[model samples]
Target: MKPHRYEEFRDLHRAGAPLLLPNAWDHASAAALATAGFRAVGTTSLGVAAAAGLPDGTGATRAETVRLARGLSRLDALVSVDIEGGFSECPEEVAALAAELADAGIVGVNIEDGRPDGTLRDLSHQCEILRAVRESVAGGLFVNARTDTYWLPGAGQAPETGERLDAYRRAGADGVFVPGLRDLRIISELTSGLTDTPLNTLHAPEGPSVPELAEAGVRRVSCGSLLFRAALGAAVAAARSLSVSADIPSYAETQALAGAFA
Candidate 1:
């Protein structure tokens, strides 16, 4: 990645309006999003894993994630990869993976604290991994520390969520992410608590709009796995009736979109 690319990606969070980030599953989806004018693109681990017949959040897609990141480096838009639990328990291994992605031209990464067996990692160990990754990137990558407190069963209370986010920020996370959190009051409270650090939340169709989220102090909104799932739904619908009336892209257009990267 270029020296200034990190700053460019970071600036999007502080640009007044919240950044509406769409997660892409592969090269074609990412390229299409870039063509549609999204400045930054993120990868959804669920999409990546499912596309490869692997399970999500099980630390089983490290090779596939790295390969996709390398391929996405060819795009003009900035890319952030989701490396679930950094794919290892050792801090050094996670840091090595972050450095490798940075060398591959990825400007950012989202490392979550959620484990594969439906539990969160130990707080201290999670912070250690964050610190190691921060040191490895040397400010050249935006490390968005993700805590799946609300995402897991029996959604963690706000107190624990705030505590974890604070520890992550102190551990050198450039930004913080909490998926499956939809309460506006709690979102406002968390944002107010972490005044300096940017807060990212997942966008839900039934939830507040982008402007509402920005008003609540969210700096970034991620469309995690929504686009990929919607694509699948559209494909099935078209196959079922052959008259879905969706604006499907032409074969030549898709070919051109994919060929541009070549």
Candidate 2:
């Protein structure tokens, strides 16, 4: 059973046929997204933390994060929990958390090496965390190791990115994610460095299209926090529009929309 689900998640990352992951912040959003036809749903750390009025990527949302993952696991879509920095620096603790998530039926997890102070965790330490997680879950979880070199200031170029990803893949990461990296040249350079390890990139509206990324060798395109933000924007816009027009949505219309989740 574990292998079956794990393979299903892993197979979604195909070179030239990337998985377009839509991130959700809560059960309602995740359910709505699954109802909308997404096979998998990733939780955005930013969306989850912000919705709960906590700081994201700062080890403040551990309980909330776990609870959300547990809830989402029961949904129709495969759930991937974004555990910022594994919610601890200790590799053993991170592995324990991953074990719990695996027991909860989560198929994937996104663990990053970026510190809240805008620095990357040392390559060796991050690799240890990945290795421990890989050992703990025993191939049941799709560990998407994330490197934030491009997302941080004063970070080095492809040489450093490739070095870290190479170590991460060697450390047993099922896939590698580089958020904030949009350059086709850099992306191509980085992907070329990996040997069969799926390259995951954050989807950028102004960046390369899916086909372009496929050509560049990206196997997974994640919409991290974009959908959550868009939902917030739509809600605010709808309220403002109603105020400006002095109009209230009809009871029938409200019920119809609400019933989608029910």
Candidate 3:
């Protein structure tokens, strides 16, 4: 039986504590993390769509997203999907997608408020969708309301981030996510108005450490596509360096890697 992991994760957030959510691109990544002892795993939309050769947040990979979620459900961790903008502009449509995710054994979903079309979806519209989604899942899924205020190019992102989170909390979101905001001072400021709702931050390379983010009152930290991207970069760099240098990967190193595939 699939574990009712959502309730446990939800309760973790409710305790004014931190939950470090590692984003997995596919089954192997998720299963490895689960075996390594993660209680929960989040799917990075960037990692997901990029693997499928579709643009993230474009509604082009809905089928791929569902397939991946289905596969990850076999793991032991609570799975939370990043369903960018819920794949539709309509509230009912978003809610329907949430229902499908729930039926797939997804314990939670993260839906953003900004669209790829370069404008913020009206907070009211986002709230309507959130409410609809909350109502649809009778078993209570964790709805993480993500704000692209910082990720999107803009000068007014900070203020917009705070406003969006405030609205999301009032709309009954279990958590709020700001993907690109990493400063401790700014994070503290932004999370002040959101009472009871956990603040979720994306893990940045130059951002505050996990302990620091926890101290800053962030309840969740997600490594969104960083590991996958880093792996790709490392592979390409290894090939390039080996071509120019004598210190290439040894016979045993190459054999060990090849043996795994074999």
Candidate that scores best on lDDT? 1
The number of residue pairs in model 2 that clash at the backbone is: 0
lDDT of 3 by residue, 1-262 (tens): 1236667878767334588888889877776667668888889899999999989877788888888888877776788998888989888988998888888778999999877777778889899999999888855588999988888777258777788898888887889999888788988887677878899988988888988888788988889889789867877887887643375456665544322322
TM-score of each candidate structure, all chains considered together: 0.97, 0.92, 0.87
List where candidate 3 sits over 4 angstroms from the true fold.
1-3, 14-17, 241-262
lDDT of 3 at 128: 95
Tens digits of per-residue lDDT for model 1 on 32-129? 99988998999999999999999999999999999999999989999999998999999999999999999999999999998988888999999999
| Least accurate 10 contiguous residues by lDDT in model 1 | 242-251
Q: Where is model 2 more than 4 Å wrong at Cα?
A: 243-262
Clashes of each: 0, 0, 0
Clashing pairs in 3: none
lDDT of each: 0.93, 0.89, 0.81
Q: Cα deviation in Å at residue 178, candidate 2?
A: 0.4
For candidate 3, what is the TM-score?
A: 0.87
- Of the candidates numbered 1 and 3, which has the greater lDDT value? 1
